[model samples]
Target: MYTEQGDPCKVLKLINSDIQSPQEGEVLVSMMAAPINPADINMIQGVYPVRPPLPAVAGNEGVGKVIAIGSGVQRLKTGDWVVPGHSGWGTWRTRALASESELIRVPSDVSMATLATMAVTTCTAFRMLKDFASLKEGDVVMQNGGNSGVGKALIQLAKHSGLQTVNVVRDRPDLDQLVTDLKSLGATHVISDAFLRSRDMKEFMKGLPAPKLACNCVGGKATADLLKYLADQGTMVTYGGMSKQPLFIPAGPLIFKDVNLRGFWMTKWNSIRSQEERQAMWDELCDLTRKGVLEAPKHRLVPLQNFEEAISKSMDSFTNEKQILSMGD
Candidate 1:
């Protein structure tokens, strides 16, 4: 646990501790796996908007099996799999105790990685697509950071919903392979930011309709470029600022095109929505995972003891694959 806000590598250290038996309305879980997301890293550095009280646990999302339940617990039982109902549960540990209301039981058979990683990325993608715009089967959706966890989830979920996607990625040495992978995941078009700006880019969209919605994760110029492809009066939703740069959209889109800009934070959504509403969304996303339609992006399973190394890798701008902490049986 960390006592101060600083470099995650320097502040977080491995510690052994004991957890008491479940009290009333509580459940004890043996964590199976958890992902190291960008938000988790930002929270560690004290850069994220939401901060847990000092001496907080390190992770925000993961999947675990219920090993014990207090007398008052009714929704979950021993042997059930569950994800945290809210954020800042300190999920990085091998096991944890949570109130029954703070845990959502899910299918135990779903792939550990998909279930472990789904709570944040897939839920965020679903909400962005469902809430921001009224998209038809053939309507188009475009997004930057196309290879990110949320980006990949959006591609799969969009394809399942019959919406087309134009995905943008940074120029990488494996650009061709990355393009191929994204296409396989349901992206209608996969192009680098440079390619998106090329002369022939407009010509390439001749058949497909202009995108009605755009998901912006990487802000700054990347968002500006993505905005250019949005159809007139389209809505652009900003959920993250990976570029760590200010966003500047020309006044023309806001005034002339009548485009709309909005922002979404899952943390805030969870805080305000009814439990039934949140549970319904979770059930839908988890159902998709069960059916093999939605999958987590490429990830490496790292033992908890190697968390510092995993944190370092996740902080690298060039790292494309996600890192998940494995709580070995």
Candidate 2:
């Protein structure tokens, strides 16, 4: 837990706290696993929009088992696997006393990593693809940060829906391997940011139809490249700003192309949607996972006691694998 907003590795401290029994409409959950996401890190540093009160537990997403349920609880029972229905539930601890309304039970057959990690990245990807545009089979989608957790999820989900994705990644020493990895995930095309800007990009665009949807996680020049290739009247949804830079949109596309710009935040989406709607989405995603269509991103499982090491690795540059805190039973 942390008492102040600062570096996550510095401010976070592990401590033993007494376990609480479930009250009315509450359930006692034993956390199984939780992934450390970029939003979790930003929330730790007080940079994210959502901030729990100071001296609060640190994690925002994870999977847990319903060990006990209060008398009024009806939706969940003991042995049910669950994830937070919304963000900021303080999932870092081994156990949580949560209201029944705060949890969404999921299938136990899926892998722990996939269950723990899907609430954010996979949900975000699903929503962006489904809600943003009227994309049909064979329609093209373009996205930057192609190797990020959400990026990978989007690629796979799109492929399953018969949509094509043009993924953009930064140049790296292992660029070839990364390209192969993305292609293996069903990415239609994977190119470097530098390539997106080079003269060859014009020739490449001639071979494929313009993308109807462009998912922007990195802003600045990379986003500009997305806009440049977006189809007329196409939609570009900005879900994250990893570059920490303002978008530089050209006027021509906004005017002549009639391109639309929008933003999405899963937390906000959850807050406004009904429980049934949310459950339907979760059920669909879980079914996809069960069919082996949605696999967990690359990750390393760190014991919960060694959370500091996991946090350190999550903040390291060029680290591609996700850091997941595993709570052994």
Candidate 3:
């Protein structure tokens, strides 16, 4: 736990504390595994807007098993797998006491890594694709940060819905190999950031319909190039700004093409949507996972005791591997 926010690697430390059995309407969960999300790191550094009180837990999402249920708890039972539906339920630790309402039950058949990760990337991807665009089979959906966790989810989910994706990634040494990997995950087209603005893009897009939906995680020029491919009156939903650059919209698209700019925050969506609405989305995602359709991102599982290494690795900018805290066997 951290008393003050600064650098996550400097401030986060392990501490042992006793946890009592669940109270009324509560459940005791033995955390199985939790992913180290960039948002969790930002929260630890006091950068995220939704700051928990001082002396806060470091993790926001994970999968666990119901070990005990309170007297009034009727929804969960011992051994049922669960994931926190809300934020601020510190999941880095071995166990947590949560209100039954704050937990979402998922099937045990799904891998813990997959379920642990659904709260953020999967949920965000699902919402952006479903809510922001009225897309159907053969529709084109484009997104930047193509190799990111959310971007990976968008690719798979779009394919599952019979939609095609034009994914954009920053140019790198292994660009060709990365393109091959993304294609295996169902990306219809994958291009480097530089290619997004090139005349070659026009040739590549000739046969494809103008993308009716665009997802931007990297702001600045990458986002602007993404907008260039959007169909007339199309919508671009911005969920993250990894480039740390401001999004500048060119007036040509806004005035002549009627493009729409929007922002999405899963945290904000969770706060406002009804429980039923949230569950419905998860239910669909879980079904996809069970059917071997929605795959989890690549991950390195580290024991909780070695979390310092995990935290350090999470701060890397270029790594595609996700860090997961393995509570125990």
Candidate 4:
């Protein structure tokens, strides 16, 4: 990794990497694809968990092939495809070395991009639904930045679990188009911030349902607005700050409504689940995707060689879409 922000990230360029020939606990992998998520850049800027040592490789998650196996490794063969864990492996390169326990196996039918997208969003959404809110089917949820990767995943998961999502977004002139996009992705309801704040909006919401969960990725005023609509004893899970401000929750909601505000970060969340529980969740989620109940997120794949251009693209204006970094020729 480079020393400072905006610095180039060519920490190691071994002409030939030799992390292979794993010992009993380790496995060797030839990585295929990794998504460069906003969290990845946040790690690059020294604002994320799982920071490696200086001159260390940096990447959070990726899909790969088992090129070799360590001694006594019974779970994987030379041809298996796996997705590495949530911490650093520096997915920008060819080879990977990690313990067999670290890999999340995927079927041959799953695309590399799908594997890459599944880790953070799915893990966060799953925990947010099950752990934070103790969500029941027919309960409603609301979230800001609903067109985001995690937002889309949340939408599908909420629908599959017999829950509803009232997605919040900023007002745009082409907002109808955005609503249509989210609805097609299984959103139950979409409301602009302005529409949500008006007096008539509460009357409108009263006719359907009040959310038991408010998922906040955007902070500042957006988060405050969502809190207004939460039901009694509702929980709000804040995972991101696309708004760059600390979340502002009104005192009345917490006191009068008995709403609970919580936080979640995926890396630590995985530590709480048993291996079988993790695998079971993964299998069910993949089954849902395979059944067309969930679609893999939309992303622009950027080749690794164009790292600078990709960074620029990620920082560009007018993009509700996220990009994934790939090892394409």
Candidate 5:
């Protein structure tokens, strides 16, 4: 399958692309499902760091069924459902070819779309909460872009881990409905960007524990304000810069309060980790998913023929959110 790369006519064209047979330590796969995350589009525009060859089959993560396995490969076999890493396995087609090391075999019962997105966002959320911050019960974390794929994953994971969340979103005419929806999904305090301007915010936070960490996806003053709300020894991890502006970290948070600022990119870590470690992390995430603690990010399925409209919709995730694309039901 081939895809176009431009603003007005971003067409993901399907053609008779040959499926290269698996070499030693490689596998041949038939695509079952794929999730069209925002970073996938950014790569096509040359804005994101991890670039596949141009005119690429454009998808980051997806579940595939092994049709054939190379001689040296022992872990995966023909007919097994496996999910490859987010960098190279574009799942916008009838079949996929990938390395045996890149595949994470999943159980037959789990949804294929769930397997697709669990790689990047869910793993990032787990690392942020457990490895990065060491969040404890009763402690608080705050973030913006609360409806994003990563943001929604964080909300579910945090709730499962016995933590409280304060989510920030843009003001809308249906603000009350939005807050209610977020609360249902584990948000304790859902407020608009305008709410950040209130001088009494510190007072509003007086009753709750000071935020131990702030996860910023929406940058600029919104990020800085989240910093101002953190406790004396808190940390902040930034993953996205949707605003396309420089992130302004406030001096006082660093100088007096000792807040640590850091950035996270899933592709870098996924590339560096060994196969055993990657599979372990994925297994842990799957356990949570099996227990119903995590849910697949909202999906908008589109047929391979309607790739243009699907690309436009997924690119607009900042306002209207969707994930997962495949041949329609």
Candidate 6:
């Protein structure tokens, strides 16, 4: 828990606290694992849009097991595995008293890490694919930040939907290996930001359909590149701005190509969507996971006591592996 917002590694302190019995409509959950997400870091820094009260526990996503359920709790029972139905539930702790409505019970057979991380990245990818455009099999989709957790999900989910993907990542020292890895996850094409802007991109575009939809997580020039190649009347959805730079879109695309620009926030979607709608999406994603169509991104399992190390690794530049805090007994 942290008393004030600041650097997560410096501000977050571990402490023991008494676990309380569930009140009416509440359930006691034993948190199994939670991944260190970029949003979690931003929230601790007090920059994210959603700020829980200060002196708050620090996590927005994780999986837990229902250890006990209080009176009036009907949807979940002991031994049920669950993920937060909404964000900002403070998932860093080993145990929590959560209202039954705050958690969504999930299948117990899936791996703990996948269950912990899927609620955010996988769900975001699923929503974007379904909500933004009327894409068909063999239609093309493009996204920046292709190696990120959400980007990886986009590739796999798009592949499973019978659509092709053009994934863009920052140029790295081990670019060749990264390309191979993304392709192995079903990315149809993986290119660096530099490659996306180069003349050779025209030749590459000739082989694939112009993307009917482009997903932008990294804003600025990378996003603009996506717009340039978008099919006429296509849509571009902005979900994150990792570049910390405002979008500088050319007027031509909107004026001449009839391109559409939009934005999405998973947290906002969760708040506004009906429970049944949310459950349907979760059921579909869980089904895909069980069928081997969706795989967790590369990750390292660190015990909860080693949260400092995990946070440090997560903050490192260009770190690809997710750091999951394992809290299970």
Model 6 lDDT, residue 15, Cα = 89
lDDT of 4 by residue, 194-245 (tens): 8988888888789767888889998998878888888889888899998789
Report the backbone clash tally of model 4.
0
Regions of candidate 6 where Cα sits further than 4 Å from its true position: none
CA deviation > 4 Å runs, candidate 1:
none
Error of 5 at 229 (Å): 0.4
How do all models score by TM-score?
A: 0.98, 0.98, 0.97, 0.91, 0.92, 0.98
Sort by TM-score, best first.
2, 6, 1, 3, 5, 4
Model number with the top lDDT: 2
Instruction: Give candidate 6's total backbone clashes.
Output: 0
Model 2: runs farther than 4 Å from truth?
Answer: none
Model 3 spans with C-alpha error above 4 angstroms:
none
- lDDT (C-alpha, whole model) for all candidates: 0.90, 0.93, 0.90, 0.77, 0.78, 0.92
- Per-residue lDDT tens digits for candidate 1, residues 1-329, read 89898899999988899899999999999998999999998998999987999999988999999999888899999999999988888889898988998888888778999988888888999999999999999999999999999999999999999999999999988899999989998898898988888998888877789899999999998777877778899999999999999887988778778888999999999999998999899889888887878987899999999999998988887577899999897
What is every candidate's alpha-carbon RMSD to the true fold? 1.0, 0.9, 1.1, 2.5, 2.1, 0.9
- The residue pairs that clash in candidate 6, if any, are none
Q: Can you write out model 2's per-residue Cα lDDT over 165-282, one digit (the tens) per residue?
A: 9999998889999999999999999999889999999999889889999999999877789999999999999999999999989999999999999999999999999999999998
Query: Per lDDT, what order, best first?
Result: 2, 6, 3, 1, 5, 4
lDDT tens digits, residues 248-315, model 3?
Answer: 78988899899999999998999899888888888899999998889998889999999999999987
lDDT per residue for candidate 5 within 203-275, as digits (tens), equals 8788799999889988988888889889888888999988877898878889999988988888888888787
In TM-score terms, candidate 6 sits at 0.98
Residue 235 of model 1, lDDT score: 94
Per-residue lDDT, model 6, residue 206, is 90
